[model samples]
Target: MKSLQLLLGLSRGQHGVSQSLAIDGVWGATSSNALASFRQGMGIAEQGLLAPADVTLDALRAGLPDGVPAALLWAVMINGSAARIEAFHQPLLAALERYGIDTPLRIAHFLAQVAHESGCLRYTEEIANGQAYEGRKDLGNLQPGDGVRFKGRGLIQLTGRANYRAYGQHCQRDFEADDPAQVSHEPALAVDVAGWFWWRNGLNEWADQDDLRQVTRRINGGYNGLDDRAFYLARARWLLRG
Candidate 1:
């Protein structure tokens, strides 16, 4: 109990006098606040005591997606912390579901691909400054700086001007025509954009068939990180279906 509290950053050590004054295994107010706060955070009742199942320690420790215990999301983001994971868990699920990634298999596949592409959501835009894509006519970079201007954004890195314009039209809103940087600025939009890309590209069918190579090719436009995508797919499959 003490270890858990400490790990969760609910510590009384800052108050040297109060820290040492424990009436037993408990530290009075510190213990009370920590326990209560954790309970609420996990969506459990505010009651002081809860059974193991009710509290969902296993589900949480396993990093289960909220409301859908049957589906487990990958928590091992390369650059994601516990706070980061918790913040986007429910919202990610919602966006995925809204974009036709409703099945456990589809959901897991979507999460894995996004995780790999965004480097676990730590990066929403490409890191290479769009220099390599300069003058790439196929990407609709006709202008001098269209490459940097239309650089990839969102979890799936929606690169290329043509792609942005098309996706925006598909959603019946102006992203590329109006503001191409909105996805970079808004976190929620970044998530939804990724879901939209998946839904639009028909990747769900490949996920259903467990054809990871095809899914990777579609998302990445080639076999850039086939092994890593495969690894994430396997992990997501276990977490969601196992």
Candidate 2:
């Protein structure tokens, strides 16, 4: 984590980096002063410490939250580049701009959701088998006449036969339920589904309220629960404010 932070800091220049090595621990006076200086430069309230309320830089660049340094996005993207983070990022911003995601909180929500879904593009199903990229599973057929299997695909791990079908129906597109052979696969489709879910289910309201639980449930379904919800919310907030 320190290595990551250091590298990110170097990339973002001194102003772009936070002086605190650990976000979880209490800070010494020196660290506090440094953080305060950082906040002052960014025009954030100088709390003299890292707090959940601290502004994130990414949020500022995307016109998200105020007082967040712009360097944070460069840091995350630099750290998580191998997976083509930009692929999701570029499209997401464009989509948000086109589809009424104008607020800082809204952009933060989607970016954070992407972070939770695939660790900010650090992992994609394609890293496994390209065929596994579409949310299929190899259920191991019992006989010749039995059905074939598939594995989860894309970011957010869109899983199950039913989910694929439902996604297709909702999006009004014929999403193939087979394997990775489809670059016609349109993996970006998964994000579209996510955006739709956010819009239709009122998840967009969670951002304004800062209600992590409600937001997680809407995006990640039953699995996020309390712990993961907190984790994601914090990450999202930090990323946006970075």
Candidate 3:
């Protein structure tokens, strides 16, 4: 772990690339400060941690998989093999780190819910035509065709114009003006949008307490796919918690 931190120019003081300051892998105050700097530079929260998969060890721009190899996100399933990690990986991990989805349980639940919503990232847009949501005032579908225009997209599937608008406001992106399609097209935004939802709703609290039921209820609006979600959560725990 120190080797990795060193390789990324984050060893104590100048020890990483300078023999003059070389102190092996002794992570003192200097090391923690450097680590915090790296996290901030990566657009992650300025928290000093070393979880090997969250904000702490995730900024491996020097080429350590953005998240761990297994946590790069299951992008697609071809012949039962999920790929797309190679093509679309960094954003998911970076967003997880940036949005305070920092703990093992938090990361596990976050990925599990997104995996289920996106079919393990195989599909970005919802399969339905969204006709059923037409003129649904509750979703801010006040305008004609708003349902089809603002259908579910992104990692956790940001649905409706109101949600898009709200998320855009939080991120200062003007999503509704630019169009919700941007969320589907941009993997980083898609991932960040989901992170935004998760953090804003404080779902991390549920994850930390091991309340998968509440997490599911908040994300899915009820126990729509409890078994599948549980399955994914268990899979996440196997790779991470184990």
Overall lDDT per candidate, in order of appearance: 0.67, 0.49, 0.69
Worst 10 residues of 3 by lDDT: 72-81
TM-score of each: 0.67, 0.53, 0.68
TM-score of 2: 0.53
Error of 3 at 155 (Å): 1.2
Regarding TM-score, does 1 or 2 come out ahead?
1
Taking all chains together, the TM-score of candidate 1 against the true structure is 0.67
Instruction: Give the per-residue lDDT digits (tens) of candidate 1, residues 1-242.
Output: 43233323322332121233222344467656655555555566646543655543443344433334311332334335445566567768678768878776887678778878987777788887887778888988887877887889998988878778877776676865678888777777788889888888898899889788898999888889888777777666655553
The candidate that achieves the highest lDDT relative to the unseen native structure? 3
lDDT of 3 by residue, 1-242 (tens): 34433344422233232222222456676656666655555666746556646644434533333334532233111111225454446787788788888876788788788777877677778889888788988889999999999998887888888988899898889866776798888878888889999988999899999788999999888999999888888756544542
Model 3's alpha-carbon lDDT is 0.69
Model 2 scores what on Cα lDDT?
0.49
Off by over 4 Å in 2: 1-79, 126-151, 169-172, 177-187, 223-232, 235-242
Residue 45 displacement in candidate 1 (angstroms): 30
